[model samples]
Target: MSPTAAPTLRVERSLLRAGHGLVAGVDEVGRGALAGPVSVGVLVVGPHTPAAPRGLRDSKLLTPAAREALVPALRDWAAAWAVGHAEPAEIDALGITAALRLAGRRALAQLAEPPAAVLLDGSHDWLSDPPGQALPGLGEPVLPCAAPPVTTRVKADTTCAAVAGASVLAKTARDALMARRHEEHPHYGWAANKGYGAPEHLAAVAEHGRCSQHRLSWRLPAAALPPAPRGARAADTLQPPVGPGPGRGARGA
Candidate 1:
């Protein structure tokens, strides 16, 4: 693709022309994980025209280095941007869906100006909090915003520039945090899996058990096999059969 192409930004401009100013897109990462925090990112792009950043797509589709490189450019291109996270404890306490909503709300709340409407990258609504309800862990009350009642689409991240921008921000932020977690708990290989349950990660868990960073609510197998013991045989073992009681056996005596 040519560097000058701006298909994503073109879509962003179309939305602006359709009379939606202060349009913010919202997305979350790390929802399907046994460990690590669920992170939400909100990015508001105004009506002003500017060159779109290169290689913008669903954050999952981008490489780590590409996502990291796009983050600062997204921040600079966006009118406003913010990220918020719901840690493992919070996810366990409130559940992933609730935690996701809480994180998205917090991220949007951080914006300097409330958006006119929020475009979410999922079918389920993320902005459905009741009016006057307080955000968990934040002393501040949840302020009413003008986000759409219904989430737009499942693939809004790839289709909408604002959502793509939000995706990049959420993914990059979560990746950085997970990398730090890797330093503290080197066994889980979170730096590599980004908290996704890969085989290596499961092996690490089986060897080390769940760490504080892991969400224990996830129903991982209790008998996860760790690495084989040194010099252990690969063959199966046989057990002796139990004989009947003496008084009851032998044709009733």
Candidate 2:
């Protein structure tokens, strides 16, 4: 069940108190899905705006209809927001970690200006390069960030408004793409399964074989694969979004 007031701006407030004037929240969607590009969302919020509605929760906690309903409200509430995706080919070319970093870079590039700090949704900062081989004298992990300083908060999507907003943005954006993919491959039930390896989707894959949109690197089920029609790729159909959304976090978050 969806809870009331799931996400708060407490993290933003703390950062604001710490002299970070501009703080953006970052979240990603579709990480584990067997198909579709991974998407990242960035949301920059202002302190003066009204508090997000009490029902704003991680996107997974909300229904698809509920999540779609919140996109307009989230756009109205956020100061600035943008979404980015690393397409299926990119995911195969680069590792998921690197592809996520690429998506985040694309998101940050859309921002009007650099944020003073970033509130990443998870404790593990995927935007950063992993620690170099641990040196004997230096016992510290030198994780390198691709963007500004980040304060990684575990479950931030459920506990922080900005992060929740980011989560919603990513979730909605990815869902829309999957919905479009559903149009091309209706048998896969992407509209319902959102390109996840749901029973229906897996069954379709088993029957019709995987398509061009499927991640080639993943240990997919053995099936008679076919090429996705050379129609409009979902990424090509993306239009600039108004702002962002608020509802759930990944798993659709």
Candidate 3:
């Protein structure tokens, strides 16, 4: 399907027909960001689900205003929805692939019940456990319930309405998070760049060194980073939230 075309429930409906009573569409945001948490969104739709509201598409195609505008409609349309995040520290401790799975599992855990099956946007099933390679203390059976069957589709965010809705929810929540964090570290311009490696962001990292929000394990720019100012929280001291709410009270969306 064309990227600009409105997403349809054709794929989700097919899953319903195949006997999956509750199908969850899954997508993630901020996976490539230089700071802040990686977020995953799950939007569950059943056979009774209605058509998506107008103007819905992949989150990347929508303006910030447009994505924020659709939040209410998207929430109303889905049987259930939730967004989950894995902090930068978690990303640095576990690899990005494992961090994505961690975030995805957290999202799935917020649902009223586990989905019968999951429709993931990308080709890789980053939502599932790594089989025998599970990391100690952080991996192996991290899923809240038994892992649901997953079906990965390339470009599912553009072609599948449910997955597209998931992307929208995830993007809005994560963007709001970065915007709020911008208040604490305005030099990085996270409010504008959303923690992606914008030129100004890279320059700030070079000048001021990494902050508590930056993923320390990532290959950051090679520059002499100064020590944190006196009384400033160290980058490694921040802790991840134990809950699924992605700072809902601070949401700018």
What is each predicted model's overall lDDT from 0 to 1? 0.72, 0.75, 0.83
All-Cα superposition RMSD per candidate: 12.7, 11.3, 8.5
Q: Locate the minimum summed-lDDT window of 10 residues in model 2.
A: 241-250
Mark the regions of model 3 whose C-alpha exceeds 4 Å error after superposition: 134-143, 222-253
> In terms of lDDT, which candidate is stronger, 2 or 3?
3
lDDT tens digits, residue span 56-79, model 2: 778877888888888888888887
lDDT tens string, model 1, 158-229? 777888889899988998999999999988888899887788787888888888898766556433445556
Best model number under TM-score: 3
TM for candidate 3 is 0.85
Residue 5 shift from truth in candidate 1, angstroms: 9.8
Error of 3 at 106 (Å): 0.7
Most lDDT-accurate candidate: 3
Considering TM-score, where higher is better, how would the candidates rank from best to worst?
3, 2, 1
